[model samples]
Target: MSARDLVHPLVLLRRFASDMGAAIRVGGVRGGLLATCLLAVGSLTPAYLPQSSPYWVPARALGLDSWWAKALGTGMVIAAVGLLMIAWFNVRPTIYVGVKHWAVLLWWSLPLLLAPPIFSHDAYSYAAQGWLVHNGLNPYEASPSFLPGPFADQVAWVWRYTSAPYGPLALQISHGLVELAGLNPYYSAVLHRIPALVGVALVVHFLPRIAILMNVDPRGVAWFSTINPLLVIDFVGGAHNDALMVGLVVAALYTAYRGRMFWALVLIGVGTAIKQPAILAAYPIAVIGSGWAGWHVRHLARFVVRLAYAFAVSIGVFCAISVATGLGFGWLNAVTVPGMIVTMAPFSLIGFGVQNLVNLITGDPNGQLIWKIAQTLGLVLSAAFVVWYAITRSRTRPVSFLAWAYLAFASFGPALHPWYLTWGGLLLPLSKPSPRVWRIAAALVSVLLVYDAGNMAWRNDLVGLALAAVAAAVIVLYRRYLRGHRPLAGLGYHDEEGEANA
Candidate 1:
């Protein structure tokens, strides 16, 4: 009840950081919690809120619908991302951030968990799809727009008419949540976060165990993967089902490493039923089951047999789930639905650029030649890498190698979302990535966080984007000139030279 009591927490946090001997003047843990709080508050703005939400009227009454208010929200987001980057970079293996950090991570997530959908409205679409199934209409056979009600109204226009591309288990879960919410769209959307939260819990439990299997520091893995800004923002805040899918995939990997291939394959099958990319986890599992020693002609037969067994078991489980849900392979037809969106994936961007260039040169805008070719090439390249990694690195560096394979496919495929990157980035810590690699990954995570907010701003309100850009530029200037290149001195500890090579 006293002012000192209220003030002591931050001071205590600072003291704790100092005791830990962190290299930075401010602890990453503290900064990360602050950033999450900022993001939670900023996420209430019009740019992030669903236009159909009942909160908008109240927001409008408070002048939160104003251009300046949107820009302010954007600015806050930019600042939060910058602070999070600084915090993550300061975490050192020497500090041994372990179980206590889990509490901090959970504390940071509370605000986000209570916030409305932040970066995306996909949860709205999820609710609508569930509504479709509840009404005895197959989601895979129909779009949300077909129903045309409160639920469909909440979906973003781009996906309004798209059939569900998610697996049967995902759709069934959504359907169940929707029914449990009494068919209320907003509540349904909120309830949809259950799967994501469960997935996050799974990751928190299993990632450290997986890290142990790779002979890496559990603290390191926990810090890098669990505290990752991208995972926090997109998976938790955005309420993407990829959270559960990737979590199941991680759990399956752990089970495989524990020498229980049957259970591992079953987990992989369940994960694949949540999202298709999870099926790819079977390759490494198959390699593990084959008892890989060294590449030899004789080993090829065993590898093939193990791979076949994996595929057969996983496919059976996937089919069983499909049959149980009565969704029955309709999702197979909708699997390519995501590719309909022209995103910033490497090949998609290239194809879009070439398509535009061709239109400019020919004065004709209907050509789809180069775009299709580029997309096909991306698929081919992704498949090639999958095969190459499966054959070569599956035995020696299975976790890291498979992580890169997932990332390669996501990056090169026709669609790339920030959450998609988390599928692989979460595994990198277990691989003992070098400091340089960590730095690069940190930079990517920072950019991705900004990109999600900026993209939303650019599409919904240009003024917001401009303000965010200005804020970003100011932060860069401060970090480069005002702060200089020196390590922070007041709080925790970092060894710049050690980290540079670590």
Candidate 2:
């Protein structure tokens, strides 16, 4: 047979193998039994080796620890790789269609939700915030340094070094719960997990509504939002607040699409209160409202009056909450402070490149000028992207606006933690499918977390080399896919102009 004939069968075999793998991983009797075993193992591993134990060494250097913990960690890495492969090949099962498929996904995700949070110390930082709130301090206004005793030691590194860049409301609520529960750190951790759980539920509940509103297939929505290892591992296990923020934003968008404008605004306001990043959703909400009003009103005067009332009600509610909290104006500063730092985010790539150049030229390994230049560029790019999306695309569905806003933020934020992508990942399935792009993006992100979880060096080579290789592969595949693809070409569910009037 010719090369083309041979390749065709090989592709078919590969696709079959992938489908079988995904089905075996998340399907019927055997799959459910395996999921239970995984969940049990995952839950027990955390109990045996708590995050605070010496097993979780800084820089993720695997030291002499319980052999079982090490084995579990290794298993996690392997499972993540396997899941990425399944998603990359689009190995969805045809055996059980529709809700049955989603049911299987939900079952598989239980273990992921139960798995221990990994890769970053942000959860610990959040726990500290709760501890402060329990001690009768306004976490919004008081730094952890002001507190004394065990809690002080726990938060000293973050309190002295890190800025409280998160919005106050969520942390404050967690804090209040910890205090009401009488200052137990363990209990506080549990309370912090509540928001993550709520976020998960919101994703599952609202995804179908969104799919219907956009007139897209709802079959894959659950897998995209819930079954994806990234969502489960980073947002659910890590208990990141981005999950809560995304949940609130999605909820508000769903409400708005249903023509409940006032309620949608209220939900959006609540979301913003949880995290300042949710403010980006306001642009889409306003756009949708304006378009609806324009179509219904005969005169511009009536439309203007309607828009004024909506703005008044939304702003009034937000201001009232702000005043009640005594948070003052510090939350505004928190929103902007992230732009001033330099780290792994895409915006910092230019900074990294410039810093290397300066070090090579001046023999000064630390060049302040190069650092400043990079930060300036990143800020400018981020601001410009946000402005462009708001002005040009605000009248579009909130999902599209949110997708772009999150991509911009993830690319431009000073520090791009894996969890930061949780926001965008939550929304991507709702937008256009560029499977090759998303697959590569997902694989690179997973690899980064895996490498970071491993020690910084393995056999004297940078452990991140493996991650970099994966990222490069993904980029190549994405470029190939996009060779003749327009940016919004396949975004068929919703029109950029407007969807069919309900």
Candidate 3:
């Protein structure tokens, strides 16, 4: 190769860096950039690091276990969430046109690229599962605890004995990453995040295209979906495979919306091979394929055909991956593993409460029947809602239908995590929701961020929790003061043109 050939790539790299730098210098992007940087630094504290992790040793050595480190890290992360929310609301399609918005995402994501899993230890389970697969074991049948090694030690205790409930493709990918990491537990956990980043990248690339097709503001969609704190904390920071699944579902939805039914179904199939919940995406795809003109019976045949095609394609992909990975069908039986824990899910909570009440009244404290009944009832109700919405509302707003369906699944399922909400929350912006809907969504996001951060601190260190509360209180009071005084520019409450739009 000539010297000019070698220098050509370098020139392009430098030019790209310069352009991104100029973009970041804009005041509109600074808040989010600074927030992500803060999040990255805060994540290095001992609280965020897995206790059994090799990564935690170094953090402890750095005196990050001190009260100040704990409190400050907690505060920084909470403050980062607040700032990111503010920055997200301020993002206007008129102002952050095109790649400028992407530039902001790049800056925000860069800091979290290598951080330890935040808010969850599920990534460690990923490492152990990959280790099992690498050792010629079926993760669907064997818990991580079977081996009793470094990898197994890193998984959360509650899940260490639970068989893998993830799809075969995810296990295969995990095996490859674990093998690539030389079986080192920490690196395996960190390397698992690569798939998540790929998923996030796919969403960043396709969500805007989908939005544009639906006549929504592409920039707004990008900002809402990509900069979502839930995405950052759960998918990227916690390294959840749902990122890959959601990314593929978004791409499939885009293709289906664009009239490529076969390809859309294929993408949905592949996505289902990563996580079963992704199959829910096919309902919307089928609706889009039907070319709905009205509630008339004319589209019924097309819808059924499309739905059947989706089912066939998804089942084929699922079985193909199962056979290819030699992990046949065991995951189907293991799918209920997450339900072992009673979470804040609407039905789970009700069941627990009812069980307690019945036990108190009947003097049978060991009773389990009531809880099981409530859980089953919740699943049935959630399923009924999904079917009702798919039939009644999906024809007009297919994407929104899918979003609400996923939300129903989360709320009424056996367990609900903050990240579960993102499955639907990410799609709301693309549906052209009303201003009130945006307000509600934003408020939920803010509340969840604070709760998760506070909960983490409460679990790990009470002192940190108190300090974090103080920090949050200060921010809340300051925001009130700002509202009373001069308007905060770029926050949508006061735009450049002096409109109080928010």
Candidate 4:
């Protein structure tokens, strides 16, 4: 009961945490497994948090979404993700060896896959969209609330009254799940996520090839791309369609690397059918496949011929999907939803800045007007960048160019959702981006996870304050640790020497 006795136990706990941190920092796959186990334990929090039916986890009935639950769950998540970053940087692919070693991540991913949706209920919209497809309704034209059901109720209010802003391929798969699961939303959601699981597997399979194309360590690429807490939380936990979209994009990039232009275009088209931004990937691949990166006139002619063939194949495949699914053109409208909402995206921040300036300078306080103008400016910039990147490869490599384009879209696009980060995150591993870029991405991901709307539901700056504190602590600890210990073999990744051996 004495202060020294209390201090002793606290010291012991700190020692224990320090050991775990060290283990994740330099330990191998075994260390990663330990981190995954802790993350799995934390994953239970979302399942237990109180939610309505169809979104129920075993603990949901206990009404655990109270203030205490929030604090505990959030802290657990922070610890797990922090550990995950450590383990990811420590990965040694050569020691791990082969797909079997990498499959350990999928095992770690399973528990979260079974948990309730964490950050977003877009999966509910997917389920509702699927229900529409099952009933021969166009998801593009129909809202979930148009006919409420177990799934429709779980969708966010903003989306519940709006049509499904997802790919036709996703809707088709969801429709099949709905038909199989009937009116039960839970089963329908799980089934919908099966595709996401497949997507994750695809990412794992192709990540090595992607690394080879970029001439980097597959271990670093795979570790950063697949073994992170964000991928686990967003792809497996939330069942976001971005999972499948990015998976397809990665696969297409791999195929393009192998000079399989026909297959690459087919895959890219299929990806585009899953998400709109994926179409951007096709442009770079088209230029690469057709050898359009060259300056010679004959090269341009060769590029045109090759591009024509690639286009024919992709267009043919897309048309077949459109015909087979009987859902055409409606999804085009769905792609514009993020632009309609004003989120914390860079453009949205610019809009807020413009709105404030207008209010102060002109005594005209029309936030929407400024927001719209800012969005238009962003749209123009993003479009121009993408067009330039696509048409002329110039100094940048094709795949690398596409990756930057994805980042441009995410940063400048409206209503930036956390899940959208996967668009760039998945590909960034294929090649090395600047450390500054990675830090920026980390900051954005941290803010998004902390400010997740479905869970926190607060507009206050509390999350921001907490994130700033965490960032400061991490920086201080890292600098101190580096001053004391041997520098990391690589900065963001583990032993470049060891990974190169893979």
RMSD in order of candidates = 7.1, 10.0, 5.8, 10.2
CA lDDT, every model vs. true structure: 0.77, 0.58, 0.76, 0.65
Task: Please identify model 2 stretches exceeding 4 Å from their true place.
Answer: 1-75, 84-91, 94-102, 112-115, 148-160, 180-182, 292-315, 336-342, 356-367, 396-398, 434-497, 500-502
Of 1 and 3, which scores higher on lDDT?
A: 1
Ten-residue stretch with the least lDDT total in model 1: 493-502
TM-score of 2: 0.74
- On residues 204-253, what C-alpha lDDT tens digit does candidate 3 reach at each position? 88888877677666656766777676887788888899899998989888
Report the number of backbone clashes for model 4.
0
Choose 2 or 4, whichever is better by lDDT: 4
What C-alpha lDDT does candidate 1 achieve relative to the native structure? 0.77
In candidate 4, what are the lDDT values of residues 1-502, reduced to their tens digit? 6768757978868755654444334445555565555555554454333244433454456675455555555555555555555554445343234334245465456556566565566777788888877777898888888776666776777887777676678789888888887667766776667888878878878986767655666665665676655677778777888888889988887787777878898998898778777777766667654534456788768767766776677767776787678888686676667666667678778887778888888877654787877877887898799778766542246666777788778878776777777787777755455566555554455445544532332322236534653675467446634654221224353211222112
lDDT comparing candidate 2 with the true structure: 0.58
Ten consecutive residues with minimal summed lDDT in candidate 3? 493-502
Order the candidate numbers by lDDT, best to worst: 1, 3, 4, 2
Q: 85-186 in candidate 1: lDDT tens per residue? A: 666656534234332544555656777887878788989999999999999999999999999878998999888998899989999999999999998998
